[model samples]
Target chain A: MARQESLNVSSSPARRRGGRKPTISREQILRAAEKFAPEELSIPALAGSLGVTHAGIYHYFSSRAELVAAIAAHASRQLEPPPPGPWEDWLVEVAFVLRGHFSQFASTADLAAIGTSVTFAPLVEALLRVMRDAGFTIRQAGDASELIASCALGGAVVLQRPNFDAAALVEDLQVAEDSPVHELAASAVDDDADAAFRRRLAVVVAGLKASLEAPTAS
Target chain B: MARQESLNVSSSPARRRGGRKPTISREQILRAAEKFAPEELSIPALAGSLGVTHAGIYHYFSSRAELVAAIAAHASRQLEPPPPGPWEDWLVEVAFVLRGHFSQFASTADLAAIGTSVTFAPLVEALLRVMRDAGFTIRQAGDASELIASCALGGAVVLQRPNFDAAALVEDLQVAEDSPVHELAASAVDDDADAAFRRRLAVVVAGLKASLEAPTAS
Candidate 1:
């Protein structure tokens, strides 16, 4: 795909004026942008890092938002389509893959916010397929897919944060010392975030399954 | 609580050196900090906005991190504790309250990532209480509370983004034009984010109930 994109850029009429056809391609720019994302993903910033003019970068991506969308698309390509299986199993895999993909970049949630659904087409398709296979009507599948996808994306955002020291903060506040809340916070001090993610995914999957089995509301 | 905090500040050794006892209190500082949070929530920013020296703000919040925690705590206080009820009903209310609270602030996810667990203590207690009352063992209650909380926080983050015009973006990409994914994206153009949240919450609640009934794993 990168090679195809590079070829398309090289063949385009917008090639820079007589400068030996700029070496960078859109894929290359997106690669560089991903490396600096969430902090320095702007076009000018990317250009500065690549030793290219800002306009030179624009030849490949028409605007900064386009560039961001491309990077998000690039990152999302990491998610493999789900193999044939029950919808719950498929969703579990999808959640894990998404959590892993988005956790790598600080800007994952931000980029996702701006990214068009095209970037997430494969994952969305897989989710919808599973929901349908699970016997949900098209409307139910659509709503379930959105809900599940949102939960996964949201979970990734929370898990990607630096481990929050609930214990230290509780001590600082000097309140809720003996409360169940304190115990929960204290336990998180040694929490494995990935394991917690899997458990939450299970909850979401379980919920969807139960909802499916329940009689439809009149 | 605000009155007590004021008394503590006025009587402290760090009290402003005999000039007017510095009128602002910690609660006042926290309120101001939250008002500008997620963008201008830093110590220097808060100080500048309050027309006070940086050191003056420190007298209230020992560091920038503390100020962030205080602000998260302040925002969380908006969550009224759920009235006594069935555990599932209680959790549903918790999810809605949290989703509502975080959605109102643009920088909610960012602030939440940095805010300490103490900031979420009250909400956590409420969730744990409900889970326990629902007959989940202590460990189960802890895990379920975390799962439910993550889902709520994550849902809020995803829903808070300006709607991605999925249909428009798909048109721009010009691929998957006739795909189920495309239909899904098109439908999102008019999605009611709140209704979707309720549906997802139902899934999580159902999942938790199922897990509780399942035999304990050895």
Candidate 2:
């Protein structure tokens, strides 16, 4: 073959793409896992769909467990960064970001069922910097971080389950008939979800701020 | 043998006296579920193990879904009530209560996952009442309740995963030259699951509180 012909064969677009290009990435593998979850899926099955060798995929992620860890890391990074400035108002924004992120990747909610304890380090690190500078003591800051991440992740799982839309769940909050307060309580549950989440966040901040400013009576 | 005699013989205390009762209450069924979970378990299997007929199990639960829902509700109610006072302190207590509840029935973590959303209405209502009484607007009370509940439930799940142990996780907070801020910034991959979780939680809560109190500066 002519030099040009050999060059074309060796440096074909497909060959140059990689040693063996697969139509898949770590993200695609995770997406498939999420889509077919609660159903055991094998690397061969994933590779078959991507038209790539199983070994090629394994090159990126050493094993199934590593792939899952990557997916979790993706989720942590996907979350909207916590808003800057004051603690209260931006918390509401963070809630929206969290909710949106969880909703967009419904399957990540399942991973959360297992917990983010095994994945998601960088996100945690970023959050620690934010909290420590905000004046939380080491232990207090630690407790708070655990509390919020758990709520966000677990809440996503809770919200995404069959027959449990976020709005409908909140609507279940009607006040009792015998209570002295009726109209206002009923109205409270009726507020839009965004409004309701922000309102609730504000109360938590108020409580935290109040406690922080004054040493806890406890 | 006469029918009456046979019935009496079957009902005799000796048949049931040495071990768990021959008849299963909802609680017994749920306990069995906890023992059998993350494994393939069904109403019939549970009944067979308890030495009862499937019909008897049906008489109590009517359906497997009902049984699972009841199991979750029972676990959720077992959570200790938050102590009277500030949101931050009470939230920490709430986290501990949920953690305790999950630890006691780790197998049912997936089953009890439902209660984190649907069956939590009563708990959320109580929280809303507390927030309102603390001088938050109805909206603010609702917002705070949602955020706190989500965090507590999510945190509990993280603590209950197969690889996580709360005591060990908490112990990872000791600072070292290689990891100066281990208090709440350790990577989740460490064998020290407790410390990693504590670190992540601290940051999330601090961010959450910070988000709440401040409006985003223009």
Candidate 3:
């Protein structure tokens, strides 16, 4: 509970009791962080696992916000989507990459949660940059980025959530027999979910292009 | 909290003590519901406001879930988007209509919350029927619908939440001055929020159109 200022933890690994140095690195911290969900990430808990004080964790990230940002940025860097050739394909690639990331943690990200806006800044930047490269003006890019984020998050929800199941949803519906929903159920054939999401992503990218006749940015 | 079976409530307004009939109607209940946010809605609280026992409220809605669904449906019924002119336009109209509805209560609908999927069934049915009439296969329409829902919900969050302020967000950015995000801020001029959302909705519609060469449903 105490700040433990006596612990001389700084840039490098800290000197423990008896001056024994522990070899900790940014890579080590990030790797350890991977084990916990983003919401579960705690500097004190993390330091405990690494055999260090919370101050030692602070050495790598000056604040908890900084630490979360680092994790987000790290993930962004690791993304290897198809080179931003055609902007639409790039968006599709990024959306799928995001799905992979969302699925990895089995975490439904609460975009409305405090600090989440910052957490997604790296993502928003990457999306905007890619669209800009394709000639979207900052205005166009910014507006479209918000829409794409929505699709990406929404796609993740539809794909991962059990409530979205076609048959189950049909079964749970409160509509009557004469309802068009009954007719709709007959058409609810099984679909390749990944393919379905990619199609939606394409629709979003294509829609963005259609909204802007040509890339308006310099 | 008591059931109060002695209150003698049913389809007609209940007779309170001394044989005086209290004429509480569904319209009265719905008008009152408009005052509370969706998450704040409570049956017992609502009944107390209407001067009815819980059983009397049940006469109108069998359960809390039914009451919520009724509220959702009532809202949906009140929506009058520009008629389904072109399929793209239809989707755009619905998106804007949805924006109006979401903004009315300052609600960001938790599509992931339990029973929300059921609550949205009416909205979904309408969306699918319009797309179907426009010749979209069920699969294309379903996929497109999910993406559009994302845009609608995401738009509400960005437009309503203070955290989305571009200047404030830029100030909070941990990126270096050399970052592209810095350049992005210069282009962050004020925009007509409604127009921006419409453009994105248009984009979504256009993308959906582009994805399918032609609708293949019977």
| Top candidate when judged by lDDT against the true structure | 1
Expressed as tens digits, the lDDT of each residue in B7-52 for candidate 2 is 3444544543344434546677778775666335687788777786
Could you tell which candidate, 1 or 2, scores higher by DockQ? 1
List runs of model 3 lying over 4 Å from the truth.
Answer: A1-85, A100-111, A114-120, A163-165, A171-180, A211-218, B1-84, B101-111, B114-120, B212-218
Per-residue lDDT tens digits of candidate 1, residues B1-218? 66755445542335334434455777677778777746456788888888988877766656564455556656675567778887877787877776666555424233333222224567767777777667876667776765555555556556656665667766775755556667667666666777766766777778888888889621
Estimate candidate 2's RMSD in Å. Answer: 12.1
The lDDT of model 2 is 0.50
| Candidate 3 per-residue C-alpha lDDT over B24-142 given as tens digits, one digit per residue, 9 for 90 to 100 | 67888888977876667888788777776666677778766556556655776566646657777777777776655544433323223211332345666778777877767777777
TM-score of the A-chain for all models: 0.70, 0.54, 0.62
Docking class of 3: acceptable
By TM-score, the best candidate is 1
Per-model clash counts, in order, read: 1, 38, 1
| Best-to-worst ranking by lDDT | 1, 3, 2
What is the C-alpha local distance difference test score of each model? 0.62, 0.50, 0.61
Better of 2 and 3 by lDDT: 3
- Considering summed lDDT, which 10 consecutive residues are worst modelled in model 3 chain A? A1-10
Tell how far residue B118 is off in model 1, in angstroms: 7.4
Candidate 3 iRMSD, 1 decimal: 4.2
